[model samples]
Target: MSRIVLITGGQRSGKSEQAEALALSLSAHPVYMATAHVWDDEFRKRVEKHQQRRGAQWTNIEEERWLSRHDMTGRVVLVDCITLWLTNFLTDGQTTEQILQDAKDEFDRLTAQDATFIFVTNEIGSGGVSENALQRRFTDLQGWMNQYVASRADEVILMVSGIAVKIK
Candidate 1:
C-alpha cells in the first residue's frame, strides 16, 4: 500500500519545507503537485518563488483545479497545498459535495499508485469566525476536507513555528 502523509499548519509554518524534505527522503524522482492559481502579480510572484525553491530535482506539475489521476510508479508525490485547490473548486461554482467527491476520487487514484504521498493543507479554521457567508462556508468545507483526508492518511503532522508535531 502507498503511504499517505498529511501535513497541515498556518501560513509560513514550514509545512512545505517539511513535506519536501520527507519526499526527498522517500524517492529520488519526486513529483511536486502544485494546486495554486495565480490571481494577481503578488500571488504569481509567490508561486514563482516556491517553484524556484523546489529547484530542478522535481518534476513539477501545476494542477489548479481537479488533481489528475496519474500513475506514480517509483516516485514520491508532494501536494504542496490543498487549500488553493479547494478555493478553485469553490469559486468555480462547484458545490461542496462535488468538491469533496472530486477530492475523494483523487485520493483513491493516489492510493492506488506505487508512490509515497505527502499531502499538504492549511489550518484555516484557526483564524476565528468569519462574518462573510462565503468565507464561513469555505472554512467549514475546508475543515471537513482536512478531517476526511487525515482519517485516511497513514501519518498526520501539525507544523507550528517550523516544528512538526505528529498527531497520528
Candidate 2:
C-alpha cells in the first residue's frame, strides 16, 4: 500500500520544510511538486529560497496549474501546497466544486501510484475571519480541501515553528 501524508500549518510555519523532510526520509530521490507561480520578483525570490533550501537532491517539478494529471513515478512525490494550486485554479475561472473535484481526483490518483505522497497545505481557517467575500471563500475552500485530504492521508501533521505535531 502507498503512504499518503498531509501536513498543514500557518504561513511560514515550517509546513513545507517538514513535508520535504518527510518526503526525503521516505525516499532518497523525491519529486518536489512546487505549485507556486512566480508572478513577481518577490514570489520568484521566495521560490528561489525554497529551492536553495531543498538543495540539489530534490527533483523539482514547477507546476502552476492542472495538477490532477501529473505523473508521479519512481520517486516519492511531495506536493508543496494545495491551497496555492487551488487558488490558481479558482482565479482562472474554475469553480470551488471543480477545484475540489480536481484535487480529490489528483489525490486519489497519486495515492494509487507506487510511490509515497506528501501534501502540504495551509491552515487557513484558524486565522480570524476575512473581511472580504473572496478571502472568505478561499479560506473556506482551503479548509474543506485540507479536511478532505487529511481524511484520506495515512498520516496528518500540523507544524508550528518548525516543529511537527501529528494529528492523525
Off by over 4 Å in 1: none
> Which portions of model 2 miss their true places by more than 4 Å?
none
lDDT of 2 by residue, 3-108 (tens): 7889999999999888888888887788998898678998889888888898778888888765546677556899888888877777667777887787778667
Candidate 2 clashing pairs? none
112: Cα error in model 2, Å: 2.3
Name the lDDT value of residue 130 in candidate 1.
Answer: 96
Residue 128 lDDT in candidate 1: 82
Question: What is the alpha-carbon lDDT of model 1 when measured against the actual structure?
Answer: 0.86
TM-score of every candidate = 0.93, 0.92
- Model 2 TM-score is 0.92
Clashing pairs in 1: none
lDDT of 2 at 158: 92
RMSD list, candidates in order: 1.4, 1.5
